[model samples]
Target: ADRPLLHGVSLRAAAGQTIAIVGQTGSGKSSLAQLVNRSYDASAGRVLVDGVDVRDWSLDALRSQIGKIEQDIFLFSRTIAENIAFGKPQAPRAEIEQAARDAQAHDFICEQKDGYDTVVGERGVTLSGGQRQRIALARAFLSNPRILILDDATSAIDSATEDDIQRALRRVQRGRTTILITHRLAQIRWADTIVVLDKGRVVAAGGHAELLRSSVHYRRIFSRFDAALPPAEPALAAA
Candidate 1:
């Protein structure tokens, strides 16, 4: 009763589809996603992953089954290859390369003097933000999990690069359930379902068009995006 971050929030992420959660800061969107992997223990109800309560699953197994991409991507002080291979240490070199390629990282990676062997500076300081995100994505791709949680994962990349990243993501998302948490309506306008949260409760949930036409919460959020968008790229407004 005290914990209402996800109050009566009943939503489903069908297999092979993407679900996005939109909300203002502190609306508990992150809290809800964290519940999926038990990042933070829920104070109230259970979080089910693959039909089993997340608390009931082995921590390692549950984590490995879900790929979480944070807003701020963190990389270690190691060669690019090693960083991407961090998740699946035993993964073959070919698989590593394929993952980078799938993440649309191979092209830029090849430009590095040492290619995949290039040593990342402290905290990956040697790379650009977009490059870092791609590497992080490659790391996730290496795991090949059943579920993907992207927490504003593409916020730093340019629109063009974001498109490439989304394309790569589209390819990998087949048959995998995805939970995309973002404030940008443009990023999630195409999600299979959109859940809107306000003040730590589910205010509205439905397909983008459905909410756009019916939910006041959805309309307010869309207006925020409309104000954020550039006139030339009103395409993001289609949400």
Candidate 2:
């Protein structure tokens, strides 16, 4: 049975803001993302983007207007340049390189023996997981859509690299709505609003601190993250 992935979940993301969806596995985070892009029509509610029903928008135009990065990155059998060009077929090579640099992919890309001309192996297996994800991000950046959705796109990346990707995403998200879907609380600390899901329903919605102090589920998850952080170093003694 196709269960309802979201139930009465009402939230908002204003222009130039970031909205993050955090929850445990099978808790509907990815479903909400797909719902927003109308990949799967809602069972009983509406999914709106920029004041318009997603279902009402023309399919090709709708997809082009919203950039999405999934956990599993997919690349074509063509050259890396062609894959990056897939987002905006007419995008100039300079623009593609700029986006790759922004994604922190240019250095590694150029280091490849074939450089931009390297053919991405089937499903991009020729590249590392992080490389493929960065390429995916570069493609999204090149699209320059009004909205961006990243569904656990950083799961395969290490913490330091994740931080770098977050920085890059911040620059790209300016003046655009960004939806980050993940189960990691640390990933949503910068979100304008964090929506917590449980049993396919919204159990909390607020900024990180507000939820940490007021929402039980949020507190529990945040406590786990807090515990994982390295202990602060003692202040250096005056010499």
Candidate 3:
């Protein structure tokens, strides 16, 4: 029998808003993101995009309008330009360069043996994890989808590299709906809304301050990472 991953989870985000999803290891966070792109059809509830049920839209048309960056990046054995251009095969060279620049990958890419023409090995095995992620980000940036979903996309990157990517993401997120699934408190703090999930259900929904003050589930999760967080909000003391 197929076990349900999420149960009665309903959430909403306005256009151009950023929503961060957080939970424990088995909390179905990634599964929730997958549903946005119809990666796995939900057995019960429906997923809507721009007021239309996603299932009703043509699969290619639906996916082409959404950009997804995951923790595990896949890069074909091709030149950096080719990979970035995969988003829009006929994209101009200048556009691909600009996307790399936006993704903070231009500098390193330029230093490569043949710059954009440098061919990578299978799955980007020749590049560092952070480098591969930046390439993936560049591809997404080139796509410029209406909705963006980031599922622990920066987990493999170091703190410094992650900071750079976050800066790039802030710029790309403008005017587009963004859904972030992450464990990083810093990333979570930037979201316009934060959703706390537990056992496939949304246990709490609000901004960082509000969740800290009202949700015990949130507080407990935060407590585990307290040292990494900034000063505890005074409101949390009374929660």
Candidate with top lDDT is 3
Residue 117 shift from truth in candidate 3, angstroms: 0.4
Residue range 1-239, candidate 3, lDDT tens digits = 97899999999889999999998889999999999899989999899998999999999999999999888888999999999888799999999999999999999999999999999999999888889889988988899999999999888887668789888878888889999998778888889999999999999999998887777778777778667644445553434
Model 3 TM-score relative to the real fold: 0.94
Better candidate number, 2 or 3, judged by TM-score: 3
Model 3 bad stretches (over 4 Å): 230-239
Which candidate achieves the best TM-score against the true structure? Answer: 3
- For model 2, name the residue pairs that clash: none
lDDT of each: 0.83, 0.82, 0.89
Candidate 2 lDDT tens digits, 110-176: 9998999999889998887788888888998898888899898877776657776777767777788
lDDT of 1 by residue, 1-239 (tens): 46556676777777788989998778888888888888788777777876888888999999988988887888898899999998899999899999999999999999998999999998888998889989888988899889999887888887668778888767666778989888666668878888889887888888877777767777776677678632332223544
User: Worst ten-residue run, lDDT, model 2?
Assistant: 227-236
**What's the residue-level lDDT of 168 in candidate 1?**
76
What lDDT does candidate 3 reach at residue 80? Answer: 91
